[model samples]
Target chain A: MQKLTFPRMGESWRTFKMLLEDLGNEVVVPPRPSKRTLDLGVRYSPEFACFPLKILTGTYLEAIEMGADTIVTSGGIGPCRAGEYAMLHHKILADLGHNIKMVVFEPPRFYPFNFIKNVYILNRARHSIRGIIALIKKAWRKLQALDNAEKLSHVIRPRELITGTTTRVYRKGLEWIDQAYTNEQIIDAETAALEALRNVPQNPEAEVLRVGIVGEIYVLLEPASNLEIEETLGNLGVEVERSMFLTGWTRDNTWTETTEGMTVKAAAEPYLPELVGGHGRDSIGNTILCAKRGFDGMIQLAPFTCIPEIVARTILPKVSRDYDIPVLTFFLDEQTGKAGMTTRLEAFVDLMRRKKHFRQGNGLLTG
Target chain B: MKAYLGIDVGSVSINIVVLNEAGEVITGLYLRTKGRPIEVIQEGLKQTAESIPPDVKIAGVGSTGSGRYLAGIMVGADVIKNEITAHAVAASMVIPDVQTVFEIGGQDSKIIIMRHGIVTDFAMNTVCAAGTGSFLDQQASRLNIPISQFGELALKSTSQVRIAGRCTVFAESDMIHKQQMGHQIPDIINGLCEALVRNYLNNVGKGKEILPPIAFQGGVAANVGIKAAFEKALGFPIIIPKYFNVMGAIGAAQIACEEVSRKGETSFKGFQITNLPYRTGSFECDGCSNVCEVVEIFEGEKVIGRWGSRCSKWDITGENK
Candidate 1:
């Protein structure tokens, strides 16, 4: 059996574990992403590269050093920088004198020869369908459980608490879920984990304003991208409801719904009707959905040079006006500072509270 | 009367433009996305609903930008097009012979080359930050100045200082060094703007066939210093359209109009999209060597949309299986 190693993105650990378990091979867990990983990435990568590219470069390098023979990565063909990340990373790694074979899953367009090569890889792996299905089911169950647990924790945790424990439990639950085979086992593990986590006791009367976060997956999920915006928001007594979670994004990307009704019910409205080539649809749809859910405000966070989120920013004002909600946009890069962001968030929240108070005073609270 | 709704969801903001059937912008809303695109769209829609006349019929909807897929789903957009196409359409509507377009938004910057009223080639900066609105905003904040005042400050400069503007880090350090060396604030600011223009030209505008009749749009076009610097560098007066900030939305709306006019119908999901229960989830795909982290959206029991599939195996057919 060929030793397969995968680069770590958010929540990728769980998926890799499950895949290795199914393949009857020992999974070599790469080290958690850290500044060292970033440093190594920067050292080996070309300057002016995007954050994801730098991180992936580091991950691949680390995995190769750990004796992993094959590395897998995804590719895209779009206006977004991600479309070129795979090729660039390949060149960087090759130039760095690493000979580990890379398997890049090609996007819909661009580089026709690469696309054909990817098709061959998929066809060769056709025999692994059962394992894939089982792995996906297990991964889905774990993710759903983790999401539910985290959501509950947000409602119950102390106002000052970062809910890092919830994230920790979620990670553990995912680990257990990956190891579990049967549905019953997965459920059993989830229930036990949920019960144990609930028993830990949290401040029941915590009052935190909910803030919905929507934007590119990297900026939303990666802590460094948005200067740990979720943590910052949480610290400011704002419960963060990020629109893009690893589980949902993966399911939507992989699962095909048979019924139109199912599709309508399960899929986000903005991304529906068609896959329109970028995160623009998801960002806009998620923004509207978040507003309707009574979030106090919306925050659209993106990288310094993200194209899609800029488009979302252009139209968010109408959404804010229609929903009577406030939306703040934050564009982050390596140069962004903590103080500036905090000030902006503080001003936004203060305005929101003032508006709420004014409405209550006017007896306009009733819809 | 038929109305059209156009939404542009960019990296830094979400803009909405409502147009009458006659193709004139009736009302436009510009708001920052602030990390919640879903809420932004909903809020934008609600505002449009309240501001526009109740009797005005929304006959078509269009979405563009990085978030167009999401925006289309949110507004049930009748047409979804790329930013270049949408921008081109809108630019053409405003300036028929728009030979070049220099768009600097909050996050990214793009240079569109057009010949004979058609896009010939284009280049975009998705990696650098020197010429973006956010960069200027950061520099302004660092200087303890309002972003709105940045342009005026640059204009006030009597002397030009050269600051490294190829990247954000180097630019900041260079500015700090110049400031410590007793350089006036205006000079430093103007130098920064000049550096940004130089960086943009070297990066995004490199090797492109730049021509006259160029129109500058997007949020960054609001900066007079950058605009002036562009003119100085290009040796041509760059036209700043009245609706520069919302040009993407206008373009999206124009595309929507074309789609609706051509089809004679619309696929807009109507206002009910505001009421739908939507959820998102993501999981890593270890099916093959490629571990694709797929994002899925659910309304309830049904799966409506999916993305983050690098191979297009999951997205091309819209079928999970």
Candidate 2:
């Protein structure tokens, strides 16, 4: 069996690990990307490559260094830069003298044969179709559990009386979920962890603000790259709701499952008119939904020079005016300073708080 | 007899202002920063102390501009704000119904859109000198005229001369080429002014609605040529407040006053800090791949403040963690 590895994008890492491990392949998990990881990516990556691409390359290099002989990553199609990442990554790694097997899963319609062949290779340990089906079911259950626990953390963190308590509990919950081998254990751990989170002292009467965070998936999910915006917002007594979840996105993309029925494309139809590549449409749709749901404000986080996000940014002001909601957009780069970020956040929160107060005074609060 | 002190330390200039409880400017001073923020601030403070009445107490202190953090720590400011907020606040204070503000500083420029006295939208120039005062200063020197007289020269233009003001390099070359063409100096100067206003509206003010009751203030507000150019371009005269050049400092003072009222106390270090043996030093921390340059400020042998690290491992204050 080949040693397989994948970059830690979000909760997707655990799902991939379970899937590959169940298939009898030795899965090597790269440590979470850090400053060192970013440095490795910066050192070898093309100067003009997007921030997420550089980080992904860095993770691959780290995984290879950790003795992983095979790389499995998703591939995009069309105008999005993501489509070229896998091929460029393979070439770059080879140039750096690391010869590793690379498997990129493109959309089934685009490369069905290659996708099936890759699956067959991964299923070397348990070749039976029934075994593969059962294995996938278990992994899917784990993904749900992981997503639920993460969602709970986002809600609880802002209302917690003690600073960092919810975060600590969430970290422990993640570890518990990671260690669970069976579907039953995963469900058990998820329930017990959420219960533990409930026990954390929380201020029931605390006047908290709800902020919806929407933007590029990688930047939104990766805490280090975004300077831990969710944690910072939570600290400032704001409840954060992410517009994207890894499990939901992956499931929807793979199985065409429409849980909400209200797709981002549909929501953004009036404003965006057409889908531009990347998360631009999603950002607009999510922000509009957040406003309709009575969120006090919205924050858009995207990498500097991200074209799709820039388009979304230009249109956000009109949305803000229409919805009577405030939106703050931050363009992150290597030179982004924490001080500047904090100042902007502080000002934005202040604006939202005042707006909420003014609206409440005008008797607009739903009784 | 209580007043708030506001300090605006920017790349090219440092402005210090004193404001009383009525939000009236008591005294204001503008000085060139010249790459020495600490020294310039101290000098400004010394001059402020000497100018102001002895009985007036400093109730609060605020710092704004790019070096806001450093100035905030140095002065023990009660409020530290960004230039956008400061500019908006000052503009709104001067003209209560101000809907738009165009602030062009020494090396930076910004546009603020206001609604009912609240800053609703804003944009700042991203590392571009084309729409800022520095470019005008450079051109003034290159044309063998003092910066103070540059605006007057611009006002004397007889014919329209177009100067490309996309980038600083191209603008300089374009200016020289126009000069070789024998267009009068004033025409070139006026053209440069119009070009700058055009660049500002195209870039910083891009996609932003430019509503009426606009107030233009900054270090660059003193340039009547730019003001006239803006008036011509927007087809409306802009309100340049009496304390135009020192608006950022005034805004900082206003925010500081509000902060003091809310907190019921002040963190102001007092003007006597001018006499203190204060110094700043920085060292690169190799503990992580980030290579954060940790800057530390000292009051004699005692380390006062530290910042610039992504992680606060080297922060001596113990507050960051």
Candidate 3:
């Protein structure tokens, strides 16, 4: 039996596991990144690697301990160091004397003999190509449903009458998604989750500050990495619209690359003409779009020492000045204190609120 | 007389202030925390009670700084705010048209940019402490010079030598190297001030427009050498507020006044809290991987508030449940 496992990412890990299990493979799902995972990862990995790399290093190690022989991960084709993550993980694991197989699914543009070999290793079930396509399509549907459910919860969270109601419903929704064994189960889970989210009582009379979050993908998606910032903002009565949802990010990569997510590229092109690697371009572009859409402010969350985000951070001040919006850039690391994060976020929210009120007052005076 | 009490409990010092209805300072006191906040808070409250007349009534209370939550719950604060907002509020009162506020305390540094009485943007130093009050304090103590007189010695320097202020380790080594180079003490201290100012501008004050009518406050603002270095860097005179060191408490007092008048009631726990034995304890909740440390506050055998847990299972204060 070919036992398979993958790094734990956002909620997409559930769908990824379901896809592998449907392919007649035993899948080991690593537990969520905890204090132990972080400590172990930091102990082994270079101290300078970005937080995502460290977290992934920890996740893969946990999965290895859970009895996995093969690791399947994606490859990137950008100036960003994310492209080298899989190779780095392979080397780091090997240096520690664990000789397990690593199946790297590179982007389609670089498809060659290695890609074919990796594919052959993955086809342990020996299913037909059409059967594989059908299974992949099934997994993609679940991905969209989960992202939509999560997106809906964001709108309801800031306005929810009772604190933590949206979070509870969303978590339960993910559990239902996890329990899915077929297409019907996925639909039922998504519908029930969406219904529960809408059913959350909200204060319609309350006004909320609209803030846009743009940053690196991992920190944006993972709650543990960013310290649950999306939920934190929502509870503080701010409507958060994030730029990088896995639905769009995954849709634009690999063999199924499409023009759907390229709009962010165009949006960011005026400020950052070239891809400096990572999500740097996407971050700038999203901030411009958010400003044009009349968001009260913008926040960029980057892992500490992330080269691309640091490059984007320099250009962001100009974007803020031109767009007439306030931008707050935060670097995430293990040393980041919870109290300090809350203090900065609270102060930023207060700034946004005051500026918004001043703008409205000016509008009323003139209009 | 009616008074609004404001307490700022920080890492190094605790400041207590009483402001009357007109926002005039009736009394202000400063005490060292010495790593024992509970004892320091009770001592400060007791001293304030003793200093003021018996007829004077504390109509409202507020708290700020890193220990704001603990201080707030202990005294039943009407307003609890972060150090940034509190400092900004206090500075605006001193310099009404203040465009920029530079605050460097013991453990952290921050820059607030304000336009037309609204804070437009702000930035705080990262996890690095190479450019804060504590940085100077450590160097002063190491050099056998009192912190109060360190700045005066720097002002008497004739020549300057640069020190790397990006990290404390590098800066300390660089200072020693300059010392071995046979440079005078005053010149090296002056160079250290400039290095700290450079680091502060490069990090905390990065991309911030430091327009004039700038107010520099906090514990570090007491250093005339740093003040001069700041002026040299920006080419503008900096305004040090009258209550530069205790501005957080002053701002808290001001905010307390506003909050109390608006609510028409005060939650000030009274000076009698000094007599009550308040106990605080913390435990590690191994519920999951997060390993959140939960803190509980007790008032004479009765649990008052509990927080610091991610799951909110043990959180009694709705702060982070």
Candidate 4:
């Protein structure tokens, strides 16, 4: 059997890796995509392709170089260009003369059945349905643990009295979770990490600006692609809450009957009225929810030339006007510079601070 | 006498202004940067020093613009700010009730919305140079007229000839076609102004409530043609300040004054910065796979300023500092 590999989008990689391993398949987890990976993708991709597709292509190229003969990646089924990514990537790799097998887990079409079949074929010899189900359950639990650790770090990092203490502990927590081999070990690591985080000194009364980040999932989870925006905001004393999480998204979209995605769709109805494609509806709904929850401001980070995001960008102004919460949208690509982004962020922070002061002086609620 | 100094080092021009405690501009200098930002800044400082009174003490110094960090390090600035904040401050000082600010500089343009002297919203042009000063400069040279006279020529037009203003390349090609169609030069120029103003309104001013009492500043405000076009399009009179071209410098100086009043001390390095032997260079740091290009500014062979690195390993001064 050929080795399988996938791009590292979030902590879901660990869960995916465990599931494939339990099925008795040799899986090669490619290293985290860096600038070198991006350059390789850019050199071979169509000039105007969305940034995420380029990163995925780069991941596959690297994995193939590391003896990964079969590539596994998520495929989109929608009006957006995401639906075309898998076929395009296949053509790009074949054109580059690297013949390989690919199994794209496209949702709502070849979902679950194809997934199960692929796993069964990979297992061949030790195919126990009960063990596979248990393995999947354990992976799900680990994903939840990983998500909780990340949420705690996001909450504690901004208000830490000693600069970088929360960040250090958060890194250790992630490392602990990543190294744990069993469900019990994962639970223990999270508890110890959370306890260490609690020990980090934080000013309870510090007035921290709360920012909600809503955008494409690839840019949201991958710090390298988005220029470590969450870290940068934390350093600037802003408590950032991400609008998307892998475990929640997977549960909502598959297997479970979850109303979270439906609720967001309803909230976005007045503005968007239709799910244009990708996360366009989610971006609008999340920004509205964040504002309703009293967040100071919202940031939308999308790849340059992205279609669905461009739709959201066009409609976000209406959201900003109605909610009275400033929304800053950044179109990121390889051409984006840190200096310009930093300057815009600083100015946006200044604007939010002054708005808060103005409301306070007028005897109104700062939120 | 105590004064505050503001240095604005932009891609197209460099400006320095000194303001007294009363917020009056004591002396100002504007020079073309022409790619040599460091040399131009030094010349601007030396020239500004010669114009100001010898007894005037530099109480505070602030730097702004695209090249602000480098300028701040060279001048020991008390406050380093972005162009939006600096421009908003400058506009508010000029017209206390300014609701909208239309700033069109050489390479970039921005629209800042304000309410009661505080900035409420702002947007800047990205990846497009259609409505900036450089676009107008190119059109002026193409039409074989001095940029200073372009505005006057537009005012003399009796009819309108539309030129595509969505992109620079399209605008130039459209201008040539209009010329071939026998449109009068003044009419074509006036149409160009109207097109650029339309582009700015459609791109930068989209979805913003631009109220009355608007102040138009930046180097591009020197052109009366664009100002008139804006006035006609928005159905409001555009107020051009006396120091419209040097407002960024003025705003930086105002911020420095505010900083000094709050802190009761100054970080101004003084006029001697002009004589300091400084050198700037950049090299790619191969620490990780990122390979970030880190720029270093040296003052007499000591690394005083470093930037452009994604990480702070070479910044010397910690990232938070």
Candidate 5:
């Protein structure tokens, strides 16, 4: 049997990658996603496909074309359409005449059998303790770097002129971390990149409006999914506070202590009560939290066929009413374009500015 | 004297309820949405306004449902709540000890679990159309039977027939196969009711700790066949409130009454809102990687509302204020 390995991006990705590598397989480390990678993903994927689908599909296809096989990915089994993506991708690959064995990591409640099967696969990997420790350390370094880079970007990008420079350096740093053999080397590369990026000049006239970004996790992270919404907001003179991040997501799943033992419910309870069958809980939580945190407004981004976000759409108006905050939900898919979205954002920002001015002038008279 | 108004706008139906200062429903209207929420709401409001006495003043308005926001804006709602909270409130008002709520509406279904008059847990099905009223309406039309009489006909079944109700496609095919196998119409109808009940139980009601005193509302509650099926399956009589079809509206109205009495004011735009020109359109925002499709709602030429934004960057009214 041929051995195959997976590249870990965050927490699970690191553990899984190590387990695979320890199994004595030729591991393929996918390049950290950059503008080029996302562009490739968008170009190759079907229009109207979810953002994550486009990016992951691009990664898998790119890896495959690079002579890699035995793809492993996580699986979900709820009302959300995400769980079915793996199977659909598998079929797509098979129909394209690619003979690859796609392994899916399932959630505990949905597929108990898959849990045992995953354990068996991990056990097959010869290096039990040593390999696991190495992977954990590598993953920690990567996560810390990514988190620091994202946080710094948020602070530095509040001004306009230096935004592009920071992003460029950040991407380069990620690439270096991915290729780094030693943890110390990875940390050093990340710090050096951050320092260089921070040296760029920022716009003095940028008006920072605290904006909240909410919606499906993949679309929120993958620039391709949201059509580079965060970047656009940054350029438009708005400070984007994204509600989803790799660190929070991992904490919600793997580390119960970090999440205060609330498990899935704890992470989701603030947004939505019980999984409304999709990212509905997240949407609800983000909306309420954004309002409570005194965010000027919130945006909900999701795919067209997303059931959970749709449910969130129905409930958001109520949230808006209760908090007296305005929430706009954006549905994305393959067919979304740039020009129209920009116009809308321009109009929305203009409206917010006008309202802010009015409220400031009139005190309590305006709507 | 204060009054409260509630509006429930669903995909298939629009329900309006008016309650007096005492929080008792005085007049109610239920109309089919017929795929036109804006139009139906307008007509329903017009009719409701006419039915009410001129002296009866609306002190507060509340809205609930998938279309709650739009309805809230149109009616100048003081409170907007989800169907779960609204239903629980209405059910508790009538059946104080109501432990379960089985609400199957036109396009969706929900199971509300209550303990001592408070909503403890709830589950809703917005994706699947298997157990919804729209499914029953489609089946009734396919069978060339009036929807109103379809439920009664289902109750007349003498023998049981099995019909797959997991999905609409599977259920329709199963029904055709059963009909071809010489099963009686009532038996097939009974089978469908059973299948729908079974599907709901397996999907929405799965692992739910259902207690007695279950109240079945929503449009599907009109179906005696489904009621019998539920009773047969659960071995307990599911109570259907008097305002079965408009419980959400009733609940909203009750909530409005409470809200206004506490606040001592009304924000209703009045029945004149019917004359307001409202238009909606979608546009993709290409500000960055998050090319969000923003939906803009305009009143005449002015953009009154904007939604479908991934970042609150678009809607100005929601920005800082």
Candidate 6:
């Protein structure tokens, strides 16, 4: 059996490993990306590469050390430099003298022969094509369930009476989803997770500010990369509306069109009509939608030196001005300090809270 | 007399302020931090305590600035706030209808937009802090002039020269080149001030509507050349508050006042803390490769509080969570 592994991509690692395991491969899962992983990557990768690139490189190295014989991950294409990540990672690994196999998964519709070879030949899928299709469908459902649980946590965390309750419950919810094998079990797990989050002792009357989170998909989805921003904001009494979910991202990236694709594009049409590269257009579109929906504020996150998000960030001030919604664009990198991020987040939330108070009261808050 | 005390321990300076029940500044002291925040804060408190009336009771205490947490625990602050909110509160209190606030401190600069006494939007210098007060301070000393006289020298300039303020390295090199070409020192300083102002507005003040009646505070506001450059750029004369150097402390004091009035009790540890022996120490936590540098506050061998951990595993508060 080919020892297969994939780089950590947010919380999807658990579900992804399960999918690979059932597909007739011994999955070698690396520990979730942490400081050690980041340091390992930074030591080898180019100094000015995108944050995700360095992180992914480190993850692959750790997986190799853990006995992963094959690395599998999707490829990207566009103005963003992510399109070259797999090639560069492979080169870097080879230069380090590790002769492991690297499989770059392209969209099946566009690269059918390569897809079949990866699935049926190298991966050795034990089931019929139809059965494999059903398995993928099941995995997709599980992922959707996990994403749902995560979204629910964003809503429940702010109102939770006991600090850290939502975080514990969310972890339990992920564990349940991971251990689930059947479709009904996945559904039950999601229901149970949401139910537990709802059952968390909470002050429902807690006034929460709605803030939309927009930016590069990697930073948005990866908890470590963004430093558990969602949790931090939630603990500070802000409800977050994440711009991208894996389901929507998977759908849009596949040959099939997504329901959210046209809407996001149309929303971004007035501000940024063309795709600058990598989620740049979508970020602008989501900010506009948030403004129209009357969100109190939105914070844009991007990797340091991220071109696409930088392009989006430069145009965001106009959007913030025209819509009367506050926008805070922040970049993430190795040097980003927890203290600085906390101060900014606290100050932004305070600004929003004071703004709301002022709008609700007529100069009565001067006290 | 009931009073609220605010302590601002920043990267370069420590400011302590006391406000009366009417929110008026009773005593304010600004002292150089010199990389020792703990000692400076205690000394500042001692100085303020001595300057104020003996009967002025400190009803509440608030801490702010970068070292807010450290200062908060040491002084038993009722409210620990970020610098932005503190500055906004102080600005609006001083200039009732203040529309804009420009705060240039030691390591960072920020622009706050306000409407109807509320902060609408704000931006801080990120990634690159090229145009902050520390940079100006360095340039002034490099020119063999005291920082206090750097601005006055600039105001005496009779010519204009362009200095690259995009990066500090480039700005310093350009200043040297201008000096080699025999450009007047006053003109060069004036050019540097204008360049710094342009960079600040372009970077931190980008896309924000900088309306008039702006209030310029923070330590950097002491530079008249920077003030002139700001006026030239925005075409509006900015008002420097009475307690410009200690505005952050004033804001923290006001916020504390409001908090104590609402809660009907104070958490003030009082002027006695200045007489106590307090120390801060940090150690790395080997929790899952994060290696978080957890800082702990101690009072005479007793651990008082711990912070700076990502997972918050080391967030110990002595007897309480």
Candidate 5 DockQ score? 0.02
Output the number of the lDDT-best candidate: 6
**C-alpha RMSD (angstroms) for model 5:** 12.9
Tens-place lDDT per residue, model 3, A1-367, is 8678887767888888888877778999877888788987888789999998898888888888988878998888888888898889999999987777788887655676766677567776877878887888889989988899889888989899888888988889888877876789889988998998899999998678899999999999888888888887898888888887888887676556556457778888888989898899889988998999999999999999999999999999999989999999989977777788888988888788778777767411000
lDDT of 1 by residue, A1-367 (tens): 4455666655556655555555455455665555566678878876666666776777777777777666666766656778777678777877888766667765434455775565445333444656665765765676666566555544433253333455455456556655666678868876876675566545556546777888778777656446656655654467778776666665544434224224333344533444344465566677667777777778888666566776766666566666767777777655555544654565455445445555556321100
Q: What are the runs in model 4 whose C-alpha is more than 4 Å off?
A: A10-15, A108-110, A122-127, A160-166, A200-206, A257-259, A362-367, B316-321
Model 5, A1-367: lDDT tens digits are: 4435343243234334544564556666654444455676677666666667766766776677777777777787677777887787787767767787777777655567886576456555555566655765676666667677666666666674733565665567666655554678768877776886577687667666777888887777656456678767666666788777776765555424344224434544644677676567767776776777787778888877677887787777667667756565677765565543554454345434434545466421101
How many clashes show up per model?
102, 0, 1, 0, 39, 0
Against the native chain B, what TM-score does each candidate's chain B reach?
0.95, 0.96, 0.97, 0.97, 0.95, 0.97
True contacts kept of each: 0.00, 0.08, 0.51, 0.43, 0.00, 0.57
Q: lDDT of model 2 at residue B187?
A: 96
Pick out the ten consecutive residues of candidate 6 chain B with the lowest summed lDDT. B312-321
CAPRI quality band, candidate 1: incorrect
Q: Judge candidate 3 at residue A271 and give its lDDT.
A: 87
Candidate 1: stretches off by over 4 Å: A1-367, B316-321
Candidate 1 chain B lowest-lDDT run of ten: B312-321
Clashing residue pairs in candidate 3 (N, C-alpha, C atoms within 3 angstroms): A80-A277
Candidate 6: where is the Cα deviation over 4 Å? Answer: A362-367, B316-321
Query: TM-score per candidate, in order?
Result: 0.51, 0.89, 0.96, 0.94, 0.59, 0.96
DockQ for every model, please.
0.02, 0.21, 0.48, 0.42, 0.02, 0.55
Q: Using DockQ as the measure, which candidate wins?
A: 6
Q: Candidate 5: where are CA atoms >4 Å away?
A: A1-55, A58-142, A145-367, B261-264, B316-321
Candidate 4 per-residue lDDT, tens place, A14-74, comes to 7677777767778898767778899888888888998888888888899899889887777
| DockQ of predicted model 4 | 0.42
lDDT of candidate 2 over A1-367, digit per residue (tens): 5899986776668888988988988999866767778888889988777788788888888888878999988887755687788899999999999998888888766577877888887887856878788888889888888888888888888788867789888879888988999888988988988898888899999778999999988888877788888887887788899988876676656645565525667778889976677788889998888889999999999987788898999999888889877888888766566766776776676567656766667321110
Task: For candidate 3, report its TM-score.
Answer: 0.96
Please list the C-alpha lDDT of all candidates, in the order they appear: 0.70, 0.83, 0.86, 0.85, 0.72, 0.88
